[model samples]
Target: MGVSDLLSLIGLFLAIIAFLDSSERKFILNKFSNRDFFLVSLYLILVNYLIFYQWWTNQIEFLNYFEFEGFPNTNTWAYFISIILIFWFLYKIMYAYFPNENKDKVLQFYKYLIAKKEYQSLFSYIEKYDFKKLRSKKVDSFQVILLEEIIGNKLFLKETASYNFFFIIELLNTNDNKVLENNFIYSQLTDQNSYTLMNIESPNQSFFKLLFHNDEFFLKSIDHNLRHNMSDLILLNKYILKFYLFTSQKKIVENTEVIENVFLKIIELKKIHILNKYFSNFSKTIVFDNNNSDSFASLFDLIVNQLNQSLIVFENNEELKFSFNIILDFSLNHYEKPYLKTKVIQSLTTKIDSENFIEFRKSLYECWRKSKKENESFNNNIIEKISNY
Candidate 1:
């Protein structure tokens, strides 16, 4: 009826409306400024005083019921009760809304990807569904490409893809080694992945940072379980880069053109490794049908050409030896029959006649000789092909 009653009613209405609004939780603490707090406190005190005065003078029935022998002011008790009820109501409303808010769709989707073992689709999946929520403003295409390589490599290995893994590469102002080192330390605690391509002691610190620290902040912002994993593929790809492309002492000065070239080489080597892994099997030889043979043949030619070009930069014989063994393994693994095996051997002998090939040839010759000694008829044609070469 009076201004105090009107103000109290308006306050009650606002409090109830706030309780009904879902987004009020975000603003509840922010809604009260120092001025708002002082005003509300003064208003409650004034209203309580007015009620006590009116009740004492008029002897109101309901007001007299709350009287006591002690100095327990009824209007003061009423004011406290009203404030407590407002807070209790807000608390109940917020509790009901918060649990539903915590059921974040993006987080659930990431967990789903991990459980389904769809690791290779992780980057695209995030980009398609939850990019805005998960991606940092500094994220770049290189980081995404690097993540793709990390997850895609799982397809080549027997290991299960991990959900708790993060991939970070320092791309910005890579001239700073200290910054790269700091990021490396952070990535370790976060990534459950057993292997990381990050080379802390790399002499080419600048480039190492570029290759390993491109999306440091972006990666760290993502959920650790969603982001961290045993980055085997990228690490293997980095092994090729660290050993083959970045072998020079002056790699620190290598320009973008050189870095881009190295990336192309890394991609090519990955392609070769993929072909070797898919086609070569100790368990059974792949029967290259017309459907697959064309693809197989193209990958085979690409591998041979890449290996030939590798001879220029490969300083270590063991590196080329490993490459030769991969080729030999694939050649031997894909052919079960003697003629098919011999045919692969012949093709290999033509491409593999260097000094390195001779050592590899002798090793194959001994293996065949050992097999022949065990059975006297293990595959005479393969031994003959090696001997002729």
Candidate 2:
């Protein structure tokens, strides 16, 4: 190939680029992938075609022409480097002479903080900012609200400021919604003391919201109410209880039956009705600690026995039977322990007060304890519990 062939090849390459740029089809096709594989396949096809073109023939041909001496010169290392330096300098000069001076670099640090849900770091750091100071900078734009992140066709101020470098900000929407809208707000610079209130309008109930700090400069004290339809609140209650029951980091308080009974009622009236689905609920959270391997399992054992006696989910549904069996199997395999034997006895004493169900649990514990004191593992204890029962 000579200078002429190279020019023709470069022209073809440029035409492909132009066609791809003008059409989304090329992106979907991904024709640029695996060029080496395509080349090898082409070579094999050409060889096969040659055999078909003329059955018996022997031929060899080689051609070469070059005017320049030492085409593969060692000096090319220094020359190519100098060429790169020259091009970089030219690009810098061009950037400096532009209308807005140099283009600002994008800050990438915000991506990690938001995506990882590193709530403590994100919220704590945002609390410290005084938005009034950041407003002074000659920034280009304030992205206080990304309209897409919240409810569709609605607005939310999810992210506002740059994490690494500052930029100018401008507010585009002043009176976007006339009705209730405020969810929260934020400050990017402040490290403490950040919250905002949004009214949660309901038929009889009310709620206030709070936001962390942010510094994108559209600093306004304007707050809005969050109105909820009946269905919305009902759905929300389910999620809130699930989150509360599973995520509450507080120590497991040793509540009396009075406390536990009240808690169950609250869960039934406020929490259970709101649940969209209970298919994924398990006795233990994914971490398998079940709050703790001790007091909590004792709690679960009591709860499951109570569930067996309840009208909550009538035991006849085959699907529910499977779910209950899973709960029992996991509890027996993971939670049975000798240490909780006396604890179970004490709990049974209180629980039996007058009900025969209490004696049932007491009997179950007797079987559970004998297996445990005999140094049975979880499986053997489960086997022993079944045999004794």
Candidate 3:
């Protein structure tokens, strides 16, 4: 290419490079990044025109280098070589500025690990995943963690696990709040055991998506209905995390309970209050087992038992108080025999005192009012049965 053509091409190429970064995730836009394409293309045409202009005017300067004597000071072939080198440097610049190009390769590696069921490889996959640098980069800030893959937003994971996870993604924006938007019950909207993709906007303006994928494990595969009724396992896992953390620091427990954000915090400060709550809620129990055919209820009962037993073993609170009976109802209404085998009516029986139970039932009804897509209610006889408790 001629000199004017070359400069025009270079300028255009730089402009193209600048154009691609306009997107939020600038890593893989249109799958191309060669800036010189447009620059060099336009330069070739313009440079040829410049050459013609030089010939028409009989300008010797246009045909010769002002810095050199003729076509180029160096060998004619060197001109072409320099063009190639320029392109190479341009490519280097593109890659250096936008480094997430290798993310596809990383994802391929992730696929391989997933295929092998290599759970431990997750740690390395996250660490090795190439990230495009932006304003702030920190271990706590950016992550391609499994949670994101399963549930787009709506949750964040602690570098370490904890029980209060359930309360993490609270709805601050009333407009999008599930309660106001008629997006209440989790089971009603989502398939009983599918990945839920949510984009969670954080108060800090930075957000991460989480993907919640439930496998056909013991509890989920229990029965067709039970699987659907299965409790929000991810939320429960968070609860487990908080419970363990509190129990571990029981000696300083009184000071540990402090919750300023009701939606975001599980148990608040006033250690005595939390301790009293937990003491009055769960029973001293340990019950999960490793079994292939175990249903959701069976496996969950085991986990609850183990969790309760562990809590009680630590003597952090009262053994039997709150109704894991709620969990039992969760398992029964969503899973069980006929539902898994064929179509059948499914109902769950949770034993609770009728007085406070009525209030709980009312709240449950209110939550499901928008969804559930069913108008049926417990028969009067059924209410009498529940009242017997």
Candidate 4:
């Protein structure tokens, strides 16, 4: 290749680099914006064009004066067309690098914004910074303005953020790798006091601690939000049981509505994991002093009511049926108090038909009869209550 030809190739290479950098496809440099790429590419392309033009002008003059040997002069139309085609090829290759699905999605989001004419101010502010220096811990003044603009826009509603926060919480409990820890998306979700602006109830740095560090705080936050929080109550059942296992008077605030709703969530979800955790850990630990005993009584009352209300589902939901059976067996075996024992009997006897629950009923009555033999003074009234059922 001639000197001008080689220079043209260099320009094409720089243009490819610029495109890759701009589109965030370059390794490491992908985090940086396109400002430097654009500036450097413009300078190199301008200088290259000038030099090529100078060489072309000389070649043209030489051709007019006398014919030269070897390949056609760089001034020829064919040479210029070849250079343009190479640049076009480089630009077109960007689409292939992007992968069609992602490229189409980006294009669609762009097209949607174009149609709405929204985010013009945000885009202008974004253009001002190279983004390499932008930190999740602290955003610049312009970035803050952009954030405020997005917050105020009708397109981004508080409800949307609230739902998303709930999603992150659920994923934190179940998903792998402990995602959302020190992540960019997590930073965006909670940073720059954005949580407040998003109307997400999660208090700034506190949310980070809740997700990765403390189970108690996570439970209390769920208790705090209660039924008002997640759009899907069924999705919350496992967490409620987890909270019930971990929570104490110090951890959870007293709210009858919240407690009832939590029970209702459990009934709706009917998940075996929740039932297993409750039988394995909850009954053994939570009941302590008179205060906790009363609380436990109230909770058992609610469970009875919820179970009665969903008897049809209980008969069909094997997990729910098995959970009640375990609760009955545990209460009979471990419960020394006549009051808690009677409550357990009353709750279990609610399923009088026993067509589907016969095994559970038989096991429970056998345990009660066995208990009566151990102590004749053991509340004859409790056995009367069981016989009445």
Tell me model 4's lDDT, rounded to 2 decimals: 0.44
Q: Candidate 1's residue-wise lDDT over 259-302, tens digit each?
A: 23332444445444433332232111223321244333433444
Runs of candidate 1 exceeding 4 Å displacement = 1-43, 46-331, 337-347, 373-383
lDDT of the structure predicted as candidate 2: 0.32
The parts of candidate 3 lying over 4 Å away from their true place are 1-130, 135-228, 231-389
**TM-score against native, each model:** 0.32, 0.28, 0.25, 0.39
For residue 191, model 1's alpha carbon misses the true position, in angstroms, by 4.9
Model 1 worst lDDT window (10 residues): 281-290
Off by over 4 Å in 2: 1-280, 290-302, 309-319, 335-389
Better of 3 and 4 by TM-score: 4
Q: Candidate 3 lDDT, tens digit per residue, 128-237? A: 23232221233221223322331122221211112212222332121123221121123222333322212111111211111111112211222322234343332333
| TM-score for predicted model 2 compared with the true structure | 0.28
Clashes of each: 16, 19, 49, 0
Q: What is the lDDT of residue 94 in candidate 1?
A: 41
Q: Write candidate 4's Cα lDDT for 1-389 as tens digits.
A: 34567566678767767775333332223222355457546654654554466565576775344445675554464456556655654554332222323433433443344345644422422333322222334544443333333322333323233333443343333322232322313333323233432443223443443543444334444554453443223334433433443445433335345445565565567665664554444344335422454556555545544544544545535455544555555555535675566555555555655455444444445556654445343335343434544
How many residue-pair clashes does candidate 3 contain?
Answer: 49
Ranking by TM-score: 4, 1, 2, 3
The 10 consecutive residues of candidate 3 with the worst lDDT sum are 199-208
